[model samples]
Target: MGVLSFLRATYDLDTLDTRFTNTSSTPYKTVIEARGDAAASKERAAKWKSQGQPSRWNTPEFYLYYFVLLLVIPYMFWVAYDASRPTDPKYKLYERLLRPGWIPGRKIDASDSQYNTFRSNIPYMAALLVLHPLLRRLYNAVVYPVKATGQGSRPTPEEADQRLNQRATFDFGFALVYLVALHGISAFKILLILYTNYQVATALPRKYVPAASWVFNIGILFANELCRGYKFGEMAALIAGPTVQNSVLDSGSTLVSWGRWLDSYGGLMGRWEILFNITVLRLMSFNLDYYWSLDRRSYSPVEKQIDPAALSERDRVSIPAQAKDFSFRNYVAYAIYAPLYLTGPVITFNDFISQQRYKAASIEPARTLRYAARFALCLLAMEIILHYDYVQAISKARPEWGRYTAAQLSVLSFFNLHLIWLKLLLPWRLFRLWALADGVDPPENMVRCVSDNWSTLAFWRSWHRSFYRWSLRYIYVPLGGSSFRTPRDAARSILTYVLVFTFVALWHDIQLRLLVWGWLVVFFMLPEMAAGFLFPKAKWEGRPTAYRMLCCLGAVVNIFMMMVANLVGFAVGVDGLENIIAGIFRDFSGFCFIISASMALFVGVQVMFEIRESEARRGINLKC
Candidate 1:
């Protein structure tokens, strides 16, 4: 009996939590609403969350999936990696295709130009993380002690304000020092930009604040990009007057060398303007959040709880506290919080300032340690892939299309997209982990594996989830996005999506390709939206077989469109995608290949559906 009990306990035949209670206050409602879509509220998340999840191990389809993956994935990987080999028959034909500006004789890591900026600073980031706890303890000791007024008592309002002021001062001081070190003298220029924006936020009429903030920040962003962050050489030349400037500030002059050395010493981010896009978002978050917080009726000016840790993530993010917390000191500290300054799992002004007052539930130590481990593992995985697969190199080199089959180009484009995802994912995770260690719980950026996606809408939601949420709250909602509103208006939503993605494209970079990419994303989303509208599960659930079949087919189409859009946008660009498309239609063989691939995608979509069902059964509905 004892042995049987031990075996049963260890094995746990019931792998999933089948019991799903649907009470009003159950966490699932919050989860659904937090997704910020009215569609989710219409029993999508709720109904799914209540379903009993069966183990995939019990299903024959699972074995089929395993077999297919075993057969296909390895072949895909081999084809992708094998083509880059020097011994491959076509390698020499494309050897000269390597793009310029990279090392002439060496294989290029296209992502290295971007990723090395983060990788090279690993030492600095590591040292800062190590010293962070000690530094925090020091700050706590001097500014706001752990026991401010002895064990059980809290400090008086005056004392609390003074302590907080000291802490903010300390935060701003550290942020200033770090920024100056990172951007050299250009840090002042950054501060000035923020300061001027700050005045606009505070001084403008309530109605005008939003418009002014948007215009000023975006205008400055374009100006900065155009001027290349006010190059030190240009600045010196301008200061010197045209007559003497040409001779005095030649490329080889002492001043030129000095500027170059300073930039090198400061690391690659010395210009500060390069990272201004991210800073611009934070600036908007601050200014916009503050502008909204001004209306006393809508946003209660009361200090309900001096500590906002008790508030939910939703409330903490969307709601602002008393006006006092939105001071310039707090604003600057939040703007340049070193870990998130470069790339953000962007936290809003309210959330950032509030989290500083008290630790939130999200900052679990064991969880953070696990997260850190995951980040390290991801970094290792990226390194291994970079070492083995030169797909990025090959793609950037623009190898001869005539030398490769349609399948080869597809695999190259596919893996290149995966590499792009990993490249962004690894850095975002690293910075997020760093912020976690510092006890600031910014949102996770990449929520799903790039390949795990089957829906175009869901892909964007999972990719850069923080930014999505930021855009949803700040941009989409303001532009009258009907995701959360009642009586769903498709026209309004579509228009909002167009406007949002348009801004998104420009915000990413002042590039024409990105603008096209944004439009393509919106265009692709139309079919998915239309299908969801036509097949309201409530009306079609009686015919589960037909509904499931329809969904599976839709998923396949969604996946295809998603791939094309992403390939055109991020992986291959218009020219490369055009080449791939042309290759596919070049012969009868390519048509047969597409048919087989579509069948494979159908099977994969079924597995993806089951995976989501299994997650829902276990009360782990992500909706995305």
Candidate 2:
């Protein structure tokens, strides 16, 4: 069995035994009633901000990113090509490299037509720059009417057409320029993003232009806002609400169901899935933010776990929407904002729209330069890391796993989490920088160090925070959350995990792997849950040193268990996981003994650090 299975069977899990809240709590009922329509809170527009409009877009520093891009793209092609031809030492090694994935009709050598060349891919270099102006014009037009009608009125046909005139006049011209200048672009890789962007631009309503452009034109982007905001999973459940369990099903029906899931969920085309989901799934949040902005009843201070009694008369959530009309352009731009379209720090519609005015602000030139430098450094770091080809390096070495010692493999398993961190870290940094250039302060994703998370809970809270917030704010709070007036039941705690994790896993994809991974996380989180149940008001440090030491040891074993579980569910295959488990018990080698000790020592140190920090933060008055 895999490490996770072994742990699952062996670990002595403590059940959270507590009194159940048999009836609905007053707090829960209040949240339910207050959710229907927002009570009039102070306009969010008048709220304070610390970032304070960092810099404007028009400065020369804002254009520094173009130079950085020029440097990176060539390097990407070089790395991809070089990885394909590992042994060959020569530059322009396409003749040796067997690159089947890249586009054809490209030439590097006269000897064979198959040879890949950067020379052939220069048009893409041109296309990246060329597409920007077209995008800007189209986006500006969509947002123009939206800002003009601040009262939330629908745009008139004349208003739409007047804005669409820019597209009408220039859409054909831009397409022609693109076709001629960058005709050789392909369907895969980076081009796929460009292709999606092109499609979005083409899909923008162009009533006066060719009829094809307006055929499947978008209705108001906030169609969900106009209607009640429904999350994607909720919508899916409602749509598949008619599904009934049948005892008459056979194994073939199970396969059929899998295929159906693949079709309906993300498996149809994975890139399209990424494109569709990151843009659309958050529409519920987008719609809700819009709803909250318009209706006063939507803002419940208690919903955020804040005390309503502490709320001031001028209380608001940042700002209310001042524009009379819904800017489909603004909404779409924020949703699919290119850099963050795939990897996200998910800025809500309100936050994004609020920052646009700063994108137009006249700021100090020095600040603009500083922002550019910092962004360039961040991009440079990502590019440098990417060039290392860490994923491929691991994949290439996987076949020779037996050659490495069991302890080495376990160490690898542990650091696999770190590897995943580096992979995500760059893209998130890139997303933040990309948005920041436009004066939008997308919230910092990794506040705590990636590898230094004190506990499993702390790690997740910082990891993809926007998604976590959505789960907590939307799913957890409505389901009674931890705000129970009565003691929480073990069953309810488990149910909270079920809803939050299943939603997260299914949100990523409806695959078994993700489900397993999500459950693994739930298992890790159980310690925190159980602690809450067992110690309702007890303090940790206030106890005897012997007790605190015992707690520290438990924390060590807990983190190690989680590391193995994470590796089993995510990083390694079943065989690898099994090998690690077997090694832990069967391997009598000194290295195995050594690694076991180090892993324990490391976790102990981390736990101590956490306790120290907690004590420091509490100013010696409270015990952790």
Candidate 3:
């Protein structure tokens, strides 16, 4: 009776027994507290997003090589076309460009021999690349601003301070570092190709070439890894050194030295660590996988997680146990295989070794050609999209992002985040084509990311799926994934996914913003997972129009939120991000329009594509 009265009074519930006339409205204090909390939580969530990370990415102007990639496609096409033309005007354009020719009448003349040598010089190209983006940035800052809004207004001290990278000097410094590292990576790539072509030859005796390639690659990478260890010496000195002199030691050393080591270490490593750390990580994966394969043990279907009903021996990617024998050579060679090294469909050692001896029959000529054409188009799309307005928006300082309409900022946010499609798409396809020609079946990295129907979880999983496979095999299943029935089991599963996101974030760039991005990813994804658990597809999904429509709405909102969070998370620094967050909240109406319009376009296109795809499938089935 007491419980009924309390419930009725507190919640204003209509009960069958209307004995208790406790129909008093919510208390003034309670209503005020709730409203305060609702407002406070929004502010709290925004600031909490930046806690303990005084930094944003705070990284360099990397990806200068993306410019090289942009130029390479056109060059490759020219080369192909140039090779085909057997006529008198053969290679005229390249010849003119290579030679010193400018403005028709007053044409600059040069010795062809001297000009050719200087023109093809790697240093010259690297310098040009390093300068191009920097110049463009400077031009935006000084000579010409892209948007009228950016040019018209002068910012306050706070606004100026909010700009993430206002230092052209720092950009130049990092651009130099970027160019140097790029040169190393390019050298590594060239060496790898030369090494692979030599190693994969039929004439080269088994074990010799792989061993030589291993030694060759490992030796190169080990040198870089050794240089990375130089920091440990600095670390030791920082840890060992005392503060406040010998007089302080009489009373025991001051504890001011506590964070000195870390500060020193960080000051020393700053941002160059990205270049060094990546090489070390790739080497670790390669070395570890090769070490495991030394014994060549074979397991039964159950142990290998092979279902009896799933695939025949012919259908599955199976290798003979004998084939798995670890040659230190194969390990090193596969680890540093140029195409797979940098942008990977992050393949495993065992799979890589197996592919080394792939049967020619498995590679259908027609299929490879089709795949090439389709992927070529994808590459073109990637290049075309790089020229997008959103790309330019992020390029310049946006400390005053608030001045732009929230819709403009939202478009910037959405596409800036989504342009990763090109980064992954361009490289993965180019590498995959070469890998395919080598008889290696590279798994798809991205599958329908844009058209993934706005499911946050699906988009995350679909993007870089090969890496997801690696995570599953190495991280997820090992942690007892997908068996969450109890609270403890559920925590384990969620923690495993959190680690997966962390790994992905850290893998891309070792930054807290990325870790937060990962957190946001898993947070957004969890609701869908919980919903799937509670409501089975047959019972709750696709049964009625309204339920399905609700699902679609949920999907759109999730995707929009995902894009917003990602953009802010990936913004240059905390202040730039702060401006964006503040801007969105200041004009919530404009944000809503941005979210709705962006989603309507994204989801609407996806829906139409899916419908067309479904119809095509049906037609194919009918024909069959």
Candidate 4:
């Protein structure tokens, strides 16, 4: 009777206030008083008021800066063309520049040279410039809508900030470092070419003419800087004044005087001069521009508030069902030819989130056969175009044919870049279906449950997708599911950085030195990682202009870095660090400034095109 009475007292039905009704009068009164006090205190809290609306980060000033950087492309083309011109005194410049370095008695005039280097490279450059925008547009049109529609609500500011920080830390710090290191090792083979070039140049019949010698010297310097450490500022300083001569001997009087003249300039102009004159600068500038245009939008509160478990039972399918929808035909059509597949058009949970809601159609034999035949043809054509023997034959027959003549080199570089896209698109689609079918019990919100940074950080995630998903599900989430506390988050950040980048670095080859380099640079995202924990409220709202600008800057910087690295890798192989460093120190010039300006412009134009295309496809006007 006593127990029943207590139970009856605790279970309130009549009173609207459950707390008071469920408890004894004395305790209930005390609880009510405490609650009242807390509510009153909250009411009295002060609120901050801002003077005005927040200003947009994307301004004309930013655009102007970007525009100037892209000019490097045209400038490099101009320089190369000029160098190959009959009136350019090419051999005289070489003779003047490298008087005592190697061969001491030969002089050649640029005007008399038979090499059509500039003309030959036009096709390659045109391909890049045209293909980049076309591909971007195709991706935006085909893929963006599929991903954007039916996305979950965005996240709150705090949640978004946390995710962004974590992503930046892991992707930038860990993945970039590891991948670059691995790439560096593979790139090291370029060094053999440099060494051979150096030997051949020295053994030439006469000492190289001043202009020719200077070009060779610059190439060597580029190789050195990339393989080893050469500060941009220092290189810029040396380039301003041409006196920063290399060891390649010149065969002309004017070469020595010209070198002396170049030694005199000491300001930004001099640096610009050096950066602009080098072929590597063009490549670097282009890369930086491309990077700048990448998407950097953060999730909105609605989008972030996802729970995978909340999905209805019917919506949940086995891994087999998931994989079933992804036929070989769709795989190649969607994955291979898709322009975004080339270099990632930002992928979000939104892109694949709808798959869970639909039933896949039964396999169609005719469709499968058609796709298979098309895929085979495409592969066969590409293989023929990229054949090593074909490339070697072309190079031997026409050494001065520029990129086309060096078809082997061109194809290899293209293959490397393209292969990344293939890996991302094909594997990602397959793995996503596999994960779903396997009944892995995805979180209530499949989109939110998966690591957001996985798509953004690593090129592989953006390109080779199977491994990307595995890393995210198995590695990222397990370490610290979305909302992590400080210390744990930091540990996860560092470890992820080390693991991903290290894997990428080691993937190409297992070299200790390459590993060391990968480790050293991979931690670049540590600052962003630390910031995530420290400033939980600092979230990035999707400001298209700002995002584009930053991506452009980052891309350009990355490309420049890669170009220098590529040069060094070409000259020194895996252990070319010493040689790369020595070459830069031995030959400094004033071409970097021009390169920087040109790169900025190129990136700006590309980004503008992308924004325009995106807006046009969406039937919306860009807000300038």
Candidate 5:
């Protein structure tokens, strides 16, 4: 009775009981706080004849969830920490902390070289962020006053066009200078690539632009990697024979000197290839956006009278009313917009152009500052994790995993995924925060915590959300992704995922393992999609507890599958993942551990469900 009383006091179970017991045909309407719309979601629910909103704090299962979490979380961490500790006396902890001359930072440094590089470049990114606002202020002071005089309170359409054109020209010049300073002579190579893509859009017939642009841009990207950025004029040799290559190769020493000289400006000089993937995405954005605009088949219309601030997400990425905004000047500026150039929470060409003309309505100084604080906290958390946890180092070392228990190996893989999550989240947030402060709002790449997700479909939706959105608009939708009008064809949807992931895998790296990982992800989603169809909410609404229990069971399986896919793709290679799986199933004890772990995970999923319900009550349905 006491325990039941505590549970009753903690959760609004009465609301949930009423919701479950009632068989009302009419859907309940609640305020949609996320969109500030109360009736919209309610009407949509009614149209679909779907169940009403979930009750807030309605979960009665949370006590068990908390109890399981308390035990599992600490045990996992304890095992991971114990297992990862260096056996070598030479690599002393005191030395790692103090950094004496004898002790190097091999252990202290992140095992993942990419993250190490990012960590080292934090200062440079910060410096760029600082310098950008000053430049923006200077431009505004010079330009805004002149435009404000003729146009009364709000600028007229013609004046807005003139202002945007001038800004684009200035941005183009500045971007060129910035790229040259950052990448030295190699900046010309990037510009040439962009120029070629632009020509494909402008010179080709509208019918041919889509195929031509994709083929050329994707072709160039693969070629760039295959030729290793065409170092030592090898591309020239391959294309134009030994004579032209010899001419270019003869000046290698001079090129080296040039690179060294340019490196004085910043350490990242002549490393344009490192950031070329992001550039390629921007290239495609310009090409496709231009192609779409030429047909006047507006994905979202941008009429002269439409307030840019009031436009929805789709509208912001639509082509502007004036065709001149699609000029080479604007294209260059949008592609290499310094804030988003290094690593993007990608903004489409139209969105970038629109935001430049009128600052995003989302840009609030207080909100931006709060976001900065969040970034700082995340960075600090990552630092603390790195300082204490050496799971990444252990994974890199590739010691005898057989020696460690299944739980330890599981925890090791688990923490490594978390590290991957944080490392990515930090840089994306930093760059995005910079963009937000500069009055441009790119998509937030990481929304949900890595551990918070349960559904595979929802996981993809939230993780690297900008990239997901980009792929959806440019690739998925065009490839016949089922929206409201079209009925969902499972086969077509599966094929679409295959193609999308194929592009995604290759785009990340031209590696076989990533491709395999993508296939694994597709395979895992089959069961999830099937389950969603087989055991939909409408069918199980009467048996709420049973339905919740069933979902929790499914979520446990999903969590393991997700971990396996990610582990194979990012943290550990095929063999390492093989070891983890083999170790887990090698004995009866291992089997028992799996049973216990699954139960714990089931509880965790119950908690996850409630969390989403809580968010729904607040009118923030992430749909993930």
Candidate 6:
């Protein structure tokens, strides 16, 4: 049976007890009853007598894993070098030293650029990989011995998991690696620019010579800002939100829409995105920090017991112990991937670990081939849209389109939006399949498709699902789940939308001012939220036609509001209520009729294509 099947059998409360009872009536029943008790003295004695001690992997084994990972870095570098042939004159010497020094000269092409970049950073990566395990082992070795004597040091599984997850041993190493690599790269680029500028300065007449100091200062500032912003944004996003919550500084506008917009458009120097990123990063980092702190607590064995009631039913039902265990591995794997680290899929630790474990398992060739093909096709489609600049044009026009243009542009925008969604969704789906095929079981509630291809809202839900999951899990649940009272729920939901949208806006760093765009969007979503509360019992019953119409309408209004907000926000930065209201009134005609018509056509095409695809899959024709 598959992992999912195994988990179902193990956790299925309805059938599990019966199977145990039937297998050995007396002992099994006693064991089951004992397991149910919070503090089963008799059962504990029996378990101790029977099991003696739990087995664990030795320190050497742990070190070996790290060593293997370190070796893999070099191997990857070698593979890249072999795949990318350099045409430069220095290539022959670089190639000759490959077997000994494992270094290669740079190539100007894309492949060469990627390879050289990875190769240059191999030492840092390898150090990070090795240092984590080494420090962990050192901590264990040093700390355990002192506690073994009457001083009372005990190592629990939770503590070990915490240590593993925090990767406390390796964090500094990784930080240093990042710093060195980033600064080194920045310095090189700055120096090159400086040299170019000096050459230009020298070429000019002596009487009209430009000050190289000014050019140098600018280069220095640019490099400093880039590195500082990247690091500061990352650290703040990882660590700041909770810290600032209780501070006096936190009392400022809880709904600073305009401030957020200014932050998005104003560049990194805009305090909004930087501050917001810091807050989010801090929130995420809190989990790891909390888990690590748990290791220091000397609680009774009973405290170690998993409490399903403590967690929400949804989370409890979705995650199995095996999945949780797998997440530790996933955290390490995903953390190192720079792209995801900066802008996440916001995956749970459990999901990540499961993905890694599954990737390590066996896979079918045919299934792998199919996954590759799907990913390639999705990527190709995205490239085509990007190359044509269709999405960019629509996005640019969105804020200023008159009524007709607004309608027309919304339609065109839908296709581009669909392509973007497809790029994220297709690869994710393939990854999901790859995990399942390799024996990793996904959560039962994972969304499979845009709501029957009928609702734009559904499409939004299906696209970048990790964001939805994060919003629901972190924001919605904490405020109180859907059982919230009508007025309170509506208010909380709106606030949640504001927070989520603001976070997303800051995440993109489009401009410091664009944070207002997020706020405006949240304000618009308020109507939808109110509608949701008013029709609490309205079920989305997969009625494609009805949902599709609703979705198109929602999309049009959303895109229209977004465009106007963005334009005004960017132009004036975040302003007071009076200014914002005035700006909206002033730009009321920004929604052009042509744009509206274009948006209509775009939606029509998408709807038609969706219907055709559905029919093809089901082998049934549907008349338009």
Most accurate candidate by TM-score: 1
**Residue range 1-624, candidate 2, lDDT tens digits:** 676654433221100000011011122223233445543212211231221222223446325534554554454445443432445332233232222222243321222121122224325533543455456555656643333533334343344334334322333343333332322221122234333433543353433222221121122122323322223333343444335323212332444454445434322123233234454434544554544455443543445664332221112224443443235544445555543555577766554443443221212233334544443554454334333323223322443454444544454455456655554554565555444443444544554334455356666676766676566655677676753334566568677877788767766655577677788888887786576556543565466445545555556656666676567555674566776566555557836565555544444444455444433332221111
After superposing candidate 3 on the true structure, give the runs of residues whose Cα lies further than 4 Å from its correct spot.
1-324, 360-362, 388-390, 393-396, 451-453, 569-575, 588-595, 598-624
Q: Can you write out model 5's per-residue Cα lDDT over 327-399, one digit (the tens) per residue? A: 8888899899888888898888888887777655556565565567667777888776676567777777666
Model 4 per-residue lDDT tens digits across residues 75-179: 443443333333533323233221121123322221111112222333553454355435434543554323333344633333433332332222223222332
What TM-score does candidate 3 get on C-alpha atoms? 0.53
Q: After TM-score superposition, what is the CA distance of residue 297 in candidate 3 from its true location, in Å?
A: 2.7
Per-residue lDDT for 423 in model 6? 43
Q: For residues 381-440, what per-residue lDDT tens digits would candidate 3 score against the true structure? A: 543443222233232333356655565455555555555555556556656655555455
Top-down lDDT ranking: 1, 5, 3, 2, 6, 4
- Ranking, TM-score, top scorer first: 1, 5, 3, 2, 6, 4
- Estimate the TM-score of every prediction: 0.85, 0.52, 0.53, 0.32, 0.84, 0.41
* Model 6: per-residue Cα lDDT over 427-476, one tens digit each: 34444443334333232222332213332234335445556655565445
For candidate 1, write residues 31-110 as lDDT tens digits. Answer: 43455777656666567656844456567766887788778788888887788777887666555643332334445343
Error of 5 at 92 (Å): 9.5
* Model 1: lDDT of residue 63: 85
Q: What is the lDDT of candidate 1?
A: 0.74
Lowest-scoring 10 consecutive residues by lDDT in candidate 2?
13-22
**Alpha carbon lDDT of each predicted model:** 0.74, 0.44, 0.47, 0.33, 0.72, 0.39
